[model samples]
Target chain A: MKTKNGMILSRYYTIADFEKEEAFLREQQRKGFQLKKFVLPCFYVFEACDPEDMVYRLDFAEVKKENKDSYIQIFTDCGWEYLFDVNGWSYFRKLADEADEDNEIFSDMESKIDLLGRVTKRRLVPLAFIFLCCILPQLVLQFTGMSSEHSETATFSTFFFWFFAAMFLVYSALFIEMGVGLNRLKRKYSKG
Target chain B: MEEKLKRVYVPMTETGFYILFCLQEEMHGYNIVQRVKDMTDGEIVISPGTMYGTLSKMEKDGLISFIREEEKRKIYQSTPLGTEILQLEVKRIERLYRNSKGETAVGK
Candidate 1:
């Protein structure tokens, strides 16, 4: 659950399906609690407000302090109320009008595809790389070191073994789940 | 006219095309969005994400250059390189238009 207002809700919005997160925020708006700010790793803070049809959208921009002002200004000029940006994800909302059924920040399929590419490039790829190069190597080392059979070294290796093993499984599941999700979304836009 | 840049942008996306087209006159990003919507009869609406991304990419690729900022909105204009690419794209579109004329174009 993302929100019901005043009470903070912690819901992890995976990078794979950001559209889902946007929908969730819109749903929250419909229910009368509007997102006030967001904290990393799944905390969405909301404030009680009159229920109104507000369209929420997310943009993946690694905006820096220098240009963030102008970046938000452009959206403001175009009529989007800039909520807050967390990490590289900028959240926005605007009153849903009569023809706002398909209201979007990016008007074309190619731009949508570009958004997907940015998410994959800036977030997913680097995370996947870390799991591949760093975690995978440690996993192998732990497995080999577990063979020492005695001393603090053996105990240390056993402890490290389980830790790496758990991390490996976590990384594997995340990689597969997000990888598939990204490919499916990309195909939907590319083929649609 | 680097072949690399042409390959990357010659067959410009609608978003790219309009951004370049609108920036032929120095204009704000949001203004360009509105202009494109008007020009296309509301067939397309450039979202802030797409607008920002295209403006940034075009500026980097030397297609659009920043002119100034007013009210915090960055103004942009097409560059010489951008104009060259746009002219090439116009020629391509002209060819497509002629083909769309179909059998009725036998006289022309």
Candidate 2:
């Protein structure tokens, strides 16, 4: 099928390549072959042809608005195996064409996730600059004979001076080491 | 006198290099991915997402230009300045090879 932009839908199928096996399974189903009683420890597998290993199964149906051919499969597995299983399912519903525009959390999540991503993106350079901008100037004044040793002006400046000085002394070497290590890892993993 | 080669900023990636290299033949994104994988012994794989992203960035930077879209995928080729930079990079690598040859020969 071609869209408005003249783009054709390319269908690609993967997994369980033997068509004959699928046909046989379908034929067996059509013939009313019932094996429910014979199979004692059976599992209701929605996605797979025959049932395998699983716990309790629930039956529920919901409409998918994106694509008309899409459907969902929910699997209730035992233990913490649910963590490894994909949570949500999306499918195209039959009435998707006539459905109203629904609420979207994606755009909101996208912005929040984007901020988190950028915040953690590049830290070393800006952090170093912040330290340089705030702390470096005070240290300069202390060692340069520009220290205001008289009255309250000297005391207040000296207090801030030592605070930044202590912070710089403690954090500088550690930050530099971390920065170098990060750059090395970045270069090593860099595809160029 | 050595010509002062202008630097071109491509994405700093193996996929970026392969994409730029394949554009010497004016191929599309999927074709570039296949050709690059074939050339690199399937060691490097360029995801469709990365390919399109890099292509857009390169086009924005004027290092690549789109020729036409065929069968949905947009075909692209290197610009004249892009080709010039490729040649300069080739020369740089050749010079490095020559310098390494002397160093290797010294130990032998």
Measured by lDDT, the strongest candidate is 1
DockQ of 1: 0.74
Tell me the deviation in Å of residue A179 in model 2.
3.2
Compose the digit string of candidate 2's lDDT tens values, residues B1-108.
Answer: 113224434223455666787888788776776787799896765643345456666776777898976544567899986676666666666766978778554565
Local accuracy of candidate 2 as per-residue lDDT tens digits, A1-192: 323322222222111111222233234334432112111132212222232222211111222333111112111100111111111211111111221111111112222232223323444456667788867876777545335566576676677777778988866865765555544434433432
**What is the lDDT for A77 in model 2?**
9
Q: Each prediction's DockQ?
A: 0.74, 0.02
Which ten residues in a row are the worst by lDDT in model 1 chain A? A1-10
Q: Write the per-residue lDDT of candidate 1 for residues B1-108, one digit (tens) a residue.
A: 477898888788888888898888999888997898899998878888888888888888898898888888888899999998999988878878888877244666
Candidate 1 clashing pairs, residues 3+ apart or interchain? A105-B47
Which residue ranges in model 2 land beyond 4 Å of their true spot?
A1-123, A142-150, A183-192, B1-17, B24-31, B38-43, B47-61, B66-75, B83-108
Reference A-B contact fraction recovered by candidate 2: 0.00
